[model samples]
Target: MKKDFLLSSNDQLEKFAGIVNGDHPLKKVTPEEKIKVGVDLGTSSIVLTVLDSKNQIVYGAYEYDHAVQDGIVVNFMESVNILRRLKAKAEKVLGRELTTACGAIPPKTGEKSAKVVANVIEETGMMCTGIEDEPTAAAKFLRLSNGTVVDIGGGTTGISIFQNNKLIHVIDEATGGFHMTLVLGGRYKIKNDEAEKLKRNKEKEQEVYSVIKPVVEKMAAIVQNMGAEINDPVIVVGGATNFTEFTTTFSKVLKRKVYKPLYPQFVTPLGIAMFDE
Candidate 1:
């Protein structure tokens, strides 16, 4: 079965904005001829988000795959090919060419790796305006104020410590959805392909979580150890934390406030859009 592309509606986006921005009089920007786009090139998936000038979500879509690994563009042409398809589909839905977009990378990426991400966007015929770290991107989407942002993507966990709404420290480590997949695969005696499917199966959630609990706990410990002044609430984003019980599990282990947006996976993409000028 094909995955559902539209995870949340405009109404949900509004609610998400309210949560992140707090109760302020929101000024709606009239839809213009052109829309801004944000793309998240994740380890396990690629996400595209379109927003009006007012920063309202107009249309968005995401596709899942294991094409890229650990924030590295292992299959450069393949990644570009996937983005081309995604951009085409999104243009069809929005009735416009997504000629410009902002993209992101994991924290502490080398200049070459960062350029690779920009090149992928350029290959899609979209001019890349800005490229930022995944955690910084999440903080922008969440409109965070003086808090740590933890982005757990498919192959790595990125942590950013913020104070006074400024990034103070950034760190990345190999620990994420792929780790969960490994645990689930070993426990169920299934191959990685089958394990991925089971991970998304609502009916198998209980069984899947049981096997991945230890790994998630270990991830929480990693966050706690890395973040010294992260006593403030931690905002969790990225596809890895999409598990139903993820927040509860992490919260229990960390013993602190953990917040997740409505569609956690799209946080980085939305943040990328926010960075667009």
Candidate 2:
């Protein structure tokens, strides 16, 4: 049997049009016509999204937990168990067995680590169709005309530079949501678990932002360090970058326009599903 592969595009505008207008034609088709799924095994959460033959979002589900730390499958069985539970939930919502999906990892991850992610997905009774870097996946979803993709997930900051919709460079470094949580935890003298919850509270945005400013600044330095390589606006994604003023803050720091898509957190998973097998 032939294997399916994820979609890789160099044209940001084309990618964006397909996602927003749903003109990819795959989305218009039925579930039977749609045989592919996308599973995002993020450090902070694992998300699964399904697109029918016409490429429409038929079902999507996600679970938040530290099963995978720093994009590595720390507890193999625990991660697999989480994937299994999410798979069942997604199957229930789609009303069918979802056996094939694409998964992703960061650009800097080793081949072995990427395979581990693929293996975890397969353990859920689903075929791992394709695997790509997180920022690459986000780029496919955004289809930016020109700029950089900054994916600030729980454990790492992934950066992908693109021009004319084609990826020209890629970089991934450790330092993301986890660092923020650690900072907040230290400042309040609370547990890391409680700090995570407090960080998500809207009322605590100001307080949390103040505490994590240094972390964000470090992220800014990462961007600044890579600025010479990219020329377009910067697009930010991932759960860590979901704070209320994140984009604005990043914009101010970088002195460039930063755009966050609708449901920014789901961007990579959706892009993973769009991979054309």
Candidate 3:
């Protein structure tokens, strides 16, 4: 019950929320300032986040794409293209070239995945200074201490238990947004792209959630199977957790407190950026 991680204050998180517009979520940073960058190549989306020298968020961009699927660079050129576009967008907004960045991959992903991540960052014209497991980067971003950080990414759900600021256990499971898309696609007999649209559309969000519930439950089960003694509140991050209904489903399944920050999708990316300096 005692808090330890360096959390963004409630007010700071409120500023981060802004709102989600899958078409384009871009925030302009104050111009002419040194900044740290974090590039997150997630299974469903690629995010570019920038923080000023003070570690305050400045500019960020998010794009929904399948360049990387399930922690692997399924499409290398697609991954590079997404990162380049996102980087260009952020740089234009901040009016300064982004030169260095940190990135993250799923827990226990092999060396090849790591190289792909680093290479994509380089292809985008930024030096990939550091690469860490997604959960550990989340922990660093959160200054996490004694709790579980569950990153429910697009193709995988990663869980890392941190006790006293040190990671105790980390696991990755292959059940995430893609599975939900499968359910939606099959139920409506639509293509994967259409299902992705339906899944991200706010208008149909509630209606489609019922169909996606099982996928969420499966993710919760994956966490439970980790077998770690998790008594602290679980902090959920990643784009898949962006679903407004997911936290409730996770809480009920885990029978423990669940928390999501203002912009769950940006957490890991922002955390990865924070680790840059």
Candidate 4:
């Protein structure tokens, strides 16, 4: 793909992040307009995204919760409740009912994980339209036809390699933002919640990152060990890739330039919305 295409995709991600961040108002849509909804039951949070028929951003919201662990729904009812609240909130903002939606899970997590994700979506009263692998969903939003997608999510780092738009090799490992939090907690002697908060604090990011850098390096090692040919445009997405030195550190280990779109955290959630049809 052209470099310009990636630049534009980053622009789209920026716009979507702005909407999710409340920097932009909810998009106005006609009653006849069709909307797509995506439910992302992430380890750190559950995100709900809405897009128009043209795939333009409409609204997005997220709430932090431990309803899921390592891309699986460990607390089914809690996951359902969080998604239910997000749906209600979206409906109130969009002034219409969301009857259908899609979701995603980590690659190779199997049909059981997909079923649970579908169940969570259904329990929220929305028809589960589809379930996709997290890296593929991120790749879709990034418009990557031939490249690598490294999704460093809250609970796992998923790697997907594509050739001619076909996903050829994929892997998922249990080293992600949660692991970083644990590392930070160990180094700071803080609780998990406090470590998580500290990990995200802008002022403390450098300190937190220094403590968690090894974890990031380990995540890169996971990718390097995948044994598949890493292609160009190796894009990193998901909430775990939020740190300033994330891609830089990952690239150093992998010995390749990695691209990260704006608001990497929201990439998968927004991409999940693309499968809502």
* Number of the top lDDT candidate: 4
- What lDDT score goes with residue 146 in model 1? 77
lDDT of 4 by residue, 19-39 (tens): 877887767888799899988
Model 1 spans with C-alpha error above 4 angstroms: 1-34
Let me know the TM-score candidate 3 reaches against the reference structure: 0.89
What is the lDDT ranking, best to worst? 4, 3, 1, 2
Q: Is candidate 2 or candidate 3 better by lDDT?
A: 3
Measured with C-alpha atoms, the lDDT of residue 117 in candidate 4 is: 95
Candidate closest to the true structure, highest TM-score: 4
Candidates ranked by TM-score: 4, 3, 1, 2
Clashes of each: 0, 16, 0, 0
Worst 10 residues of 4 by lDDT: 1-10
lDDT for each residue of candidate 2 in 79-98, tens digit (9 for 90 to 100): 89988987887666556788
Q: Judge candidate 2 at residue 189 and give its lDDT.
A: 99
In model 3, the worst 10-residue window by lDDT is 19-28
Off by over 4 Å in 3: 1-10, 19-33
Candidate 1 lDDT tens digits, 1-277: 1122223432455554553344434334333555678888888888777777767766666777667888878888888888898899876655667778888889997788789999999988989998889899888766666778889988889999888788999888888888898888888799998988888788988888888988888878888887466746687888788778888988998888687766677778888877777
